[model samples]
Target chain A: MSLQIPDDRTPDGKPESEQPQWRRDFPIDWPEDNYISRRDFTRFLVLTSFAFAVGQTWILAMGSMGRGEDRQGRELVASVDDIPEGGAKTFTIKGTKEPFLLVRMSENTFVAYGQKCTHLSCPLIPQPEMGRLYCPCHEGAFDLQTGHPMMGPPRRPLPRVRLEISGNKVYATGVEDHRL
Target chain B: MPVPEHLEFFIDPNRCIGCQACVQACAECDTHRGYSMIQLDYIARSESPQTVPIVCMHCESPTCAEVCPADAVKRTEDGVVQSARKPRCIACNNCVLACPFGVPKMETPMELMMKCDMCYDRTSVGKKPMCASVCPSQALFYGARDQIERQRPRSRPIHRFLFGRQIIVTKVHLMVPFESPVAPMDVIAAFRETVIGHVFGPNFSAETMVGGGK
Candidate 1:
């Protein structure tokens, strides 16, 4: 049987025989292959560098803008009579989706805090009898008066939502962002 | 030269109670956007309520990064595997399917690949990952190799894993019994057989187990 060689040509349509000896002999072009690989790698590195720079710039911009823009000031959450002493009510902040808990500690005293637990963002339930906010998932407890982590794995205090009493209305105004 | 501080995470499946504290804490990660990257899976519930917490193992040669057509997945200089770059991610799910540990998940709504970055925001500052912080049980432990080794002497930290013929070296360490080289496999087998006496300790009753039904 006669040996048949398949016809292959360069991108320019030049026949194998018509090309330079180096090009014909070393069709794989190891040096060129290496160059292309290095080029791609360099390109990737440059792109990555650009991405990092952009990320840094974005972080800087966000930092400069400040987190205050998201804070809602003086939003009515509940009335004094809505919750009895030792009773708690959950309310969502106005103009935001954040949930806050309002607890009436005594006849005249009321406290409010961001509903999420400091340790894991678990919705905290107020244990009126224990005088604490408890995370059922891990039994993490926070002092009802201060929102300070009392027991369990939580190390940080719950974010205290500032409350204002006007006549009989309890308004959630500002928040103490102290994270324990 | 002094050994580099390669802080690896050690997960003890036997200690995981599946309370989902880690999952909740992971979502609270500053950069996670309230999305949890950690997963708690029940190894066996019928016989025993044993669970395993799965996070990004952060392999030395991460297959997720290698398979990403968009080059979105990245590994930090410290070897922690990061989530896909939101802008560059094409939501192809290549990394999701390529990950050996099944860590990466496609956030369909955002069309981005999300996975555990080992709470890099906190870890970079020398703080433990969120999952490790609120684990309650010492299932997820993150710290310097020497410190962790001292705390739990019986279980050795292992970074090498064998998948068929391929040997994968992970940046995150897995705690396995000191006597076994194939720790993960052995642990799984032990769990399947419900050999709590061997895995845990002598007091291996249901009442003794965390969150176990008596």
Candidate 2:
């Protein structure tokens, strides 16, 4: 059966031959035409709404699955004496290429955070003398103790990398989800 | 071809590196008194380290100038939109509310409307604006329209924009990726998927929104 609909115009309307160039180029029955009936448009809208729901559901499922996997892994980053007091060491996570910094603030205290500055993701430099993490790109500074922004542009605290110490070994447990 | 006497300033977001050199240099403008008008917005620093700088577009029919009840905002002969004059400014935020690009800010304590003037103090004398001069990444560039277009063929500098029903022609040009022209260009729709998110996103860190914690 032919899918093309018969055009019975030209009774009072413009004749087919005399129609505008745009109308001729894009014929009423063009195969790939975007035109659709009101019912079809409504149906397409409903399908689109359904598709968005399904996509969001899939994302939610994937996010939950990823979170479960995240809780299972713990990577050893450095030893207790690997970094001296008032020093910093940079290391990548086991599966991720992103680097994290470990700062030994004092003899007994060690803190770790994502090396990317909160301002613009420029690599941060630990200023041991000034007791802060500094980003040279924009003069962004973060407090060494709490990893909170203390000066310049950065407002968000550096994403803290959860750390555990046992028997002279420093273990990077997991990244804390600051959002939750 | 001779360069146009009134050269148009253009910015390419693709080249921006988020260094904030432009922001620091803007403070050096003689009249602004250490208040920088340039804003470096992090597009998606969490996902990627992309940034786009925001400055006054200097529209052909400036909404700021039109909305100013006290006749404080003025456009120069060369088309640079000046900030609200301190003496005549009524501290009414009509210009701030009317600006489609969200470029103006009301300094509450000072009771004055302030925004990017394209460094009129320097540009009037044929000098480059502070931001364009200091931008290390060359994201902010100032040159004649013909020269700039010739140098960067991949991107086209566009000043005319169609937003819904309004047609806005700007003095400052935005470098947009080349696309076949078939209809009136909607700059807002183009920005909606990219620049708008960075500028208007709720999750934007406070520092990125307002530089240096202010």
Candidate 3:
């Protein structure tokens, strides 16, 4: 795909190869406005509940089997001097297409966060002068220091990306998922 | 007034080719990032392939805003109904369920209710929405009433809709067949007829549903 980031729907990703244009680009998986009987609605709810239970069981099994696995390997992001104080640089980690923002607070203090906003996932624009990250889509904002939402519709804090500085280089360790 | 005067949005379901160009262009709109606010719906998949593009009607009295417990949804003086406010929206999914057009969507990841704001960012600056701009069929139009009438002479724009006993007047207009006296569409009655017809087959009568026992 030309875009490092994919859109909401699945990208055809075919034009690059000069493939024939398929008639339908947007294919909705779920039914919209389709009629459902009372029995069907009840069955849907029951199935959803069972699916959640199965998901929990699967997670438990995966946790047991994947214990001690280093899922997030250290990936070099940028150097301290690369980003000026009160400015941010964007980068992506290995095996993930999502981007992250690394903002330099001072010569010593630096923080990183996932670029996607907590609300609606519009790419968050770093407003270092204002000491916050701003989402233009809904005017959502997050604190620069803690990633907690300071203003707008976003209810949860931006996921903080763990950073490790060694020598002149900064490395992204893993994302500290604080979404609750 | 956020939305400037003389400019309006029109939806003519008849012209929709089911190509989803509106949906594609909407996601590409600078305001929404990659999210498309327009919903493409089929009238009935079993019978025909007729499709409708549903944008926020931006009602005079928005049901989505009325049902919002957190007061997240806001309508400007210009009559543009905005997406739910971030800090204020509780993600209760009230707007999603309450919207007659099924416009507002609850993003599970973001826990926010988002819908078409008529591209308020663009529209406030006097630009057409991305969807309307790219529609090959002109099914979705954003322009003056005079221009639309000249182009689609047989089509009349209606902003009023009836749901059961309630009448909703919207900012956005739906281009319908031109008639002498355009009545507000009775969505509930039409829905009742469709549902009853499916259950009782073709021979069902409207009077029977109202306890006339014909």
Best to worst by lDDT, what's the order? 3, 1, 2
- DockQ, ranked from best to worst: 3, 1, 2
Clashing pairs in 3: A152-B86, A152-B87, A153-B85, A153-B86, A153-B87, A154-B86
Q: What is the lDDT of residue B210 in candidate 1?
A: 60
Candidate 2, pairs of clashing residues: none
**Model 3: CA > 4 A from native:** A1-180, B180-182, B195-214
Q: lDDT per model, in order? A: 0.75, 0.74, 0.77
- Candidate 2 lands at a TM-score of 0.47
- Chain B TM-scores per candidate, in order, are 0.82, 0.81, 0.87
Superior candidate under TM-score, 1 versus 3: 3
Query: What residue pairs are clashing in model 1?
Result: A156-A180, A157-A180
Residue B114, model 2: Cα distance from true site in angstroms = 1.2
The residue-by-residue lDDT of candidate 3 on B53-122, one tens digit each, is 9999877657887677765676665767778767667899998987877799887678888889888788
Residue ranges of candidate 1 with Cα displaced over 4 Å: A1-180, B1-6, B183-214
TM-score of chain A, every prediction, order shown:
0.62, 0.59, 0.61
DockQ for each numbered candidate: 0.01, 0.00, 0.01
**Which regions in candidate 2 have their CA more than 4 angstroms from the true location?**
A1-180, B1-6, B180-187, B190-214
lDDT tens digits, residues A1-180, model 2? 001112222112345677666544433222323445467789999999999999999988876764423423677888988788898999988777768999998887888988998777899999977989999999889988888999888878877887888889998888754422
Residue-wise lDDT of candidate 1 within B1-214, one digit each (tens)? 1113565578887678899999999999997989999888765455678888999987766778767776567666566668987767899999887776779989999999999988888888878899998989879998777887888888887776655444556767778788875743422233334443235533466665666633
Q: Provide the lowest-lDDT 10-residue window in model 3 chain A.
A: A23-32
Tens digit of per-residue lDDT, candidate 2, span B150-206: 888898776666755666667667787888462445856745454433445433567
Model 3: residue A35 alpha-carbon error in angstroms: 41
